[model samples]
Target chain A: MAEAVAGCVRHGLPAIGLWRQNVAEQGLDETVRLVKDAGLRVSSLCRGGFLTAPDFEADNRRAIDEAAALEAACLVMVVGGLPGVVPGEPLGEISRDLPAARERVAEALALLAPYAAERGVRLALEPLHPVYCADRAVLSTLGQALDLAAPYAPETVGVVIDTFHVWWDPQVFEQIGRAGREGRIASYQVCDFLSPLPDVLLGRGMMGDGVIDFGPLTGAVAAAGYAGDVEVEIFNADVWAADPDEVVATMKNRFERLVVTRV
Target chain B: MAEAVAGCVRHGLPAIGLWRQNVAEQGLDETVRLVKDAGLRVSSLCRGGFLTAPDFEADNRRAIDEAAALEAACLVMVVGGLPGVVPGEPLGEISRDLPAARERVAEALALLAPYAAERGVRLALEPLHPVYCADRAVLSTLGQALDLAAPYAPETVGVVIDTFHVWWDPQVFEQIGRAGREGRIASYQVCDFLSPLPDVLLGRGMMGDGVIDFGPLTGAVAAAGYAGDVEVEIFNADVWAADPDEVVATMKNRFERLVVTRV
Candidate 1:
């Protein structure tokens, strides 16, 4: 947690997305203190889902409490997949009832939304890639995310646009525009991939190295009037093993070279 | 070449997509004779284009001749990329002038179309996945393919829908429907992938093993009124290394179980 915060501070990155494990490891209070000291914004708390289980009430409330403790701007929910004792596995394998699972997610979000709003934390619904549809998020498209957020006030519910997950989407620009117009574009992440990829979760490229035309993509988002900080989130093992300072410097350089120049 | 044709015959698959090298190895006359003997339809010949180059007229003409000789229903084109020659490579890198390349493709197709029509072969415009956008087909979507085919008649030009390249698209159904309605849906290929995949070419899955809902997809194509063969074109090394008979049997079973049930 300290390392992440320090990296964000040294890199002059305005904000950072935090994983729940990092917070738990440092103790939420210490993590929050470090973030405050660094004067960095919490773009979002890493995640707060896996809510499809039978005992979602307890898990959802705990996520809310953690987000509150961290004073996060939004509790980014990686909504759980299925309902069962083993909480993290996808819900589809055992249950054929997708509509019911979706309803369960909505209910969990509903329960957490008011608390998050009370605590001044927005609820950001991230539509994961379709690969995770069965076990991670049933909400697999930006259109679907907007549809999910349609019933809620923009301040209460919004969407996270992770480039790695959404770059392949033909409707990305249209959806980003819709989100901006509707005031539901909560956060934007930037990452790249050379597809027909394997182990998709970890094989993301470092910006320009992949085929994604980030220039046009970031431009489209900004054109849609999104003013949020661009979060550089790469899950590649290659990047993770590199010197942290070098990685941060490279990202800063790429951000200016690729994103700022285009937008 | 003989092995591939024999495997197709033994497996009872209605059609087989043949690569150009395999066709060349068997000699065009023998290849045609073998395919005829086996009583299998030649779904689509695996190539015809690298036309982004300055000296592609001869190669393009040869490809057309080869397609005619092989008796392929459709000559599937994987259009070439950038203009410069890469070191240690025979062909040059992709050109940045996408519009010029598109025009080149159009010109080549126009010249070959009449000849192809005479030989009773169709020109199938296969819009490759975006990852190949730099060096492969700039026609990366069905919409793009249709747009390219707009000036040509359906009898002269059509689009090939390879599910592996297109299933990630949210607009696939809409585009497939549009293609069918416009009479541009010429060939349909089925293969699956678990996204965040590696080796974009060889990572393809057998039907029903990956994320694509084959039943729904094929059903949509059929509903759009396409009475074409569902070619199971898998490129997985796992499946490729297995006994050829086993692979065919598996595909046959999957076609009946998943595809037939849906259609």
Candidate 2:
């Protein structure tokens, strides 16, 4: 976490998105102090959802408190896929009731929205791609995410527009417009979807490195009234193995060439 | 193809879906003779569309003729994905315009629907899973396929409801209902979507082995008034490598246990 903060400073990057694990490893207070000392803004806390888990409420409460302490824009929420799917455990008799799983997410939000609002932390719901619907996230489209967030105040609950997750959606552009109209566009994340992927979870590519044409997506976000810092979120194995400095430099260059000009 | 017909007869299965490659290798007329002699029905032809390819028109017209000769229910259409993607070739400079790729499908249907109708064959547009949106088929949702079919007569243009493709869609049930109303449910293909897929193209599971609950989906099909023969379309390497007799027996058992009872 300290190295990430220092890297942001060294690379002249203005902000960073902090994952909860990294935050925990460095200790929340120390991590906050490091980012503050480095004069780097916290873009958003990495996550706070996984509503299907046993200790969801307590864990999410702590996540909200951390986001509040960091003064991040919003806490990214990755609503869990299925019930009783513990990390590192062998997947057992899986529940096939997707609608019921989604209902759990809605119920979780109803309970958490007020608490998050009190803490001034918006829960940013991210709709992962449908490929991840069985194992990673049940929310598979921005439209569905918007529907889930409808009951809460837009200030308390918002939806994320991540290119890698949503580029294949038929209704993505229209959903972005709806998000703008509802004032629920919380964060804009960019990454390309590379095919012949080595690993499904870690197959995201840097901007302009794959098949996504950024001009139209960025244009949609801009037209939808999103005036926020765009974040790069690549999880490719090759990218992670590369030198961090080079990765940072490449992402910035790609973002400028492929995203910024269009936006 | 002859062996498949013999196996279907030996297994007491009444019908079979034939792929073009197998038919080509066996000689189309010989395939027709073989199935006829074996007293088996042809549920549907495996494929017909690749609208973005250079020889699509000629190739698809031939596929329609083959389906007609085999007396198949529909000519399944797997619309081409991005333009200029050739099989077994290194992918290079892919066209990222998905909307445009979809428009090409629409245009191709407009041209072929009349021809197919005249030949007493329905062009069944199979909306492949969105995971294949980049390389296999641009038609990723039944709704999109329905929209493309709206211009033609319902008997002439129809959409396929493949479980592996449309199961994850948020609006799948509603769209299935809509397809029923439109009289566009040409075929019902079943295969489970297994996680940690070995090869995305060939990772389909047998019905009872994966996370899909056959009850609601089969119930939906029955409610939607589809009385077509349900086809098994597993593409798994293990299933392919297993003894054909054992594979057929397992599929029959699973179908009875998981799908037929539900319906």
Candidate 3:
């Protein structure tokens, strides 16, 4: 965690998106202090939405607190997939399918929304790709996530525009426009989509490494009036194996070429 | 092919979905005669898409003729994904991506729709799961397929409702209802969707084994007025390696309890 923060500073990056596990490893208070003292901003906290967990409210409360401590823009939420071992739910013995899981997410969000708002921490619902609907997240599109956040205040409930996941969606650009109009574009994540992937979860390619034509996508988002930190979140094995400095350099280059210049 | 047809006869199964390759290997004439002699019906021919191929028109014409020769119900179409490596076309030199591939599919369908209409072979557009949108079929939803089939007569161009492929779609039930109202349902294929899929293509599970709650999905199709052979197309390695008799038995058993009885 320290290495990452120092590396960001060294690379002249604006902010750091910290995962909860990494934050917990370094102790929340110390991590918060370290990031703040170094003048780094938390773009967005990694996550907090496995609503299938038995103690979802309790867990998410802590996640909100952590995001608050780090002063994150919003706590990104990956709503749990089918009624099963939700990422945050160790005691998750849920029996719901897609529709049921979706209902549960609304219920879970209702329970957390007020709390997040009270803490001045926004809840950013992220829609993973439909491929992960069976196991990773029931939320599979930006429109659906926006619908889920409809009843709440835009500041209290927002939607993430993760290019890796939403790049394939036909409704994405329109939804981004809606999010921007509604003041719900919490975070914009960039990553390319690759296929013939051996393991689906780890298949996210670096920006510009795969088939995604990010220029139009970014242009659409920009047209929607979104001016926010765009985080590069690649999960490929090859990308992770490269030197941190190299990966950072490549990401910035791709971000400029594929997104900044076009948008 | 003969063994499968004979087995279907012994088991009192009315029809067998035939793959074109299998028919070609057994000699089209002999295979057609064998099924006809055994009083077995061809539910639907496995495919005839890859529209990006250079010789797509000629190839599809042959497929249409083959389906007519076998008296198959429809020619199930797996519209080719991104342009390159389409089935024919000399290892395929096409460079079109998703949108281009989709446009090519419509163009190819426009050309073949007349040919198919003249021959009495319905073209069944099977929208593969979105996960396959980049590599297998650009048509990733029943709605998309229906839209593509909009300009044609329902009898000439119809959409397939494959439970395994579309079970996760948020718009699925509504789309199935639409297809039925439009009388555009060409085939009803069933297989369960399993996640953490080792091989994306081979991840389709036998009906009841996966997380998919097939009851509602099948019910919607049935409620939409589809009364056709529900072909079970599983590409799982284990199921493929299992004894044919066992595989058939399991599929029938699951189909009854998880689908027939429920829907």
RMSD of 1: 4.4
Task: Indicate whether candidate 2 or candidate 3 has the larger lDDT.
Answer: 2
TM-score, each model?
A: 0.83, 0.97, 0.95
* C-alpha lDDT (0 to 100) for residue B216 of candidate 1: 63
lDDT of each: 0.73, 0.87, 0.83
Q: Specify the highest-DockQ model's number.
A: 2
Model 3 per-residue lDDT tens digits across residues A1-263: 99999999999998988899999999999999989988998999988988865668888999999999899998999988877644323323445367888898999999999999999999999999888886778898888898999999999999999887886666677788898899999998888777555467887887755656677778878888878888888888888889999999988888887767452
DockQ of 1: 0.17
Chain B TM-score against the true chain B, each candidate: 0.89, 0.96, 0.94
Candidate closer to the true structure by lDDT (higher is better), 1 or 2: 2
Model 1 residue runs over 4 Å out of place are A50-61, A79-119, A128-141, A194-199, B49-61, B79-120, B127-144, B194-199
What residue runs in model 3 are displaced by over 4 Å at the alpha carbon? Answer: A86-96, B85-97
TM-score of chain A of each: 0.91, 0.96, 0.95
Residue B170, candidate 1: Cα error in Å is 3.2
How badly does each model clash, as a count of residue pairs?
Answer: 17, 0, 0
Deviation in angstroms for B199 in model 1?
5.1
lDDT of 3 by residue, B134-154 (tens): 667878878889999999999
